[model samples]
Target: MQRLAGNLRTIDPEASESLRIVSYFDVLISRGASVDALLRGAAVMASAVVGATVRGRTIRRDADGRTPREETPTTSSRIDGGEWTAWIERPGVPAPLDDVILERLALGIALIESRRRLPGGVEVIIDAGMGEAERVAVLARMRIDPGALVRVIASPAGALSGADDAVILPTRRALVRVRLDRELVPPQKPGPWGLGTVVRADRAPESLETALIALRLTDERDRVVDASELGSFLLLARAFDPDHPPADVVALSALDERSRHVLRALAEAESMRSASAALGMHHSSVQARHEALTQTLGYDPRTPLGRARYVAAALLMRLAES
Candidate 1:
């Protein structure tokens, strides 16, 4: 089809380009591509940024197929597709094919969103932004008891396998699997997973929020973090401001990787000797590194207060990077 389109373009560029746009979206719809994928396709095809607003959430992708670091003024080529609206960001003047791309993009988005509203559409069930009445209706449609408990498991996109009973929805940060708590099984693969606390089906958005936070706290030492076990740590993660992180978080970010690894070991290990063993270094060497770390960080990571500070800084550092 692409070869034909390329050949046809040499004869009639306008008609060939229109055929190309239709073909691009038809293939995406056939494969059930995610909204992110659809927006990225439009962005690339139009050589500009594209965005969609669904359920009060706005997602955008740049022409390079990455989320734009900042927002810029956009062209007025927005198209409404029932449950969602799609737009192109071409600034001064729109490209010739921008209209067709935006039209097909909106059609693709509508098809995906409509399918997600059907029975067993776990996307609607776990969406925090959906109305209570709508959620209850969806639960009834899917034959899910509103009072029954469920958990939202969040992992990197395409990370989970054999999720036959769960609806895997792609969010900006992760792929969330919403399934009944009773049916939840340990993931088959190693994970940097965030397991949300079990909650009533209607309160899934709350679960998803904490699950994503727990995911952010995961590191090499602790690959899986359960939100139910977080306690006060959950509060700290919520209260942290990524845009203006605390001084300790900033300091931790400035250190080299080796220094950060040593600090992580010091924070987790019960003693200097244990820390050295974990790092495969001599105890005396670890002791000297600890002294240097104290001077560099302006705090003793081994002390009770300093340990708490280090833990917060390290976790917040992850949040900032994410």
Candidate 2:
């Protein structure tokens, strides 16, 4: 390696690295290396060629190749330490979507999330600005032609989630978000994705909040619901910020777990016996707990009004933690 570097001191660095790797492969093959060895070596050599071509880089090598490495951005003129020539990004990488021109053709839900553990995979923001034709053009740039999606899925710098069945509506700011996969739903229209609360493509802000609420409440059910279908849960989610939960919500921490479980279980279950069965408790004990909790909460959590509040509080608790 040192001899190759010394000999190629004044050569075009990219060409020099390419020639060096070719020579290295030739040497390995002549020494009776296997096809697998050449295959792996060729892959590494290609990356090294790209690095050297783009950045005039010299890699730090081991007996094998391509060790764990990170390059620090610097402007110093001296080679003070080890080789730090690896380039972090390629030169020809393109942005996902420039600015979309949208159309008002159709609107629906696309539940999106990241395909990997990383964030910033996809981003889309919708307002009254752009039209559907422009949105389709933008999605075309992304190499996705979802047949009927009014918008586009522009995954810029890998910023948007790539799961084909899910759409991540931006619930917070641009970057920080969550990923939850569901195999149970069909894909909606393909387009750029953004996060908001209630998941929909319409103009209602409350719908975005409702989507967030539904996401928080989502379990193993085959169907993921819409904010519009959630009735008053949408209203509650719109009004309720997790940071400052309502007075009754704060009071919940003071209540015993059994009573709290009873309240929540009864709130969701159709009957006391069913609620008790779900909770793994006897029907009689659940009845007692229910009456006690009903008095403590001022309204029975099982009642219409109280059920709404309880569900909202539960969602808020989850939101705050998340």
Which candidate's lDDT is highest?
A: 1
TM-score: model 1 vs. ground truth: 0.68
The candidate that wins on TM-score is: 1
**Residues 1-322, model 1: lDDT tens digits:** 8898989999999989999888867765665556766776787788778888887778887653456767767565889866688899877877788889988998887887777655535655665545677788878887778888878887765565466545444333333444434455655579888888788888877787687787777877789888888888888887776768998998999999999889889988998889999999999988998999899889999899999999888888887786
Error of 2 at 229 (Å): 3.2
Model 1 lowest lDDT segment of ten? 170-179
Worst ten-residue run, lDDT, model 2?
Answer: 98-107
Give candidate 2 misplaced runs (Cα > 4 Å): 1-213, 219-228, 253-257
Q: What is the C-alpha local distance difference test score of candidate 2? A: 0.40
C-alpha lDDT of all candidate models, in order: 0.76, 0.40
Candidate 1, which segments miss by more than 4 Å at Cα?
1-77, 82-105, 112-117, 171-180, 239-244, 277-280
TM-score of each: 0.68, 0.41
| lDDT per residue (tens digit) for residues 4-91 in model 2 | 7667857666545555544554443333232222222432433321121112223332112223264434311112112222222222
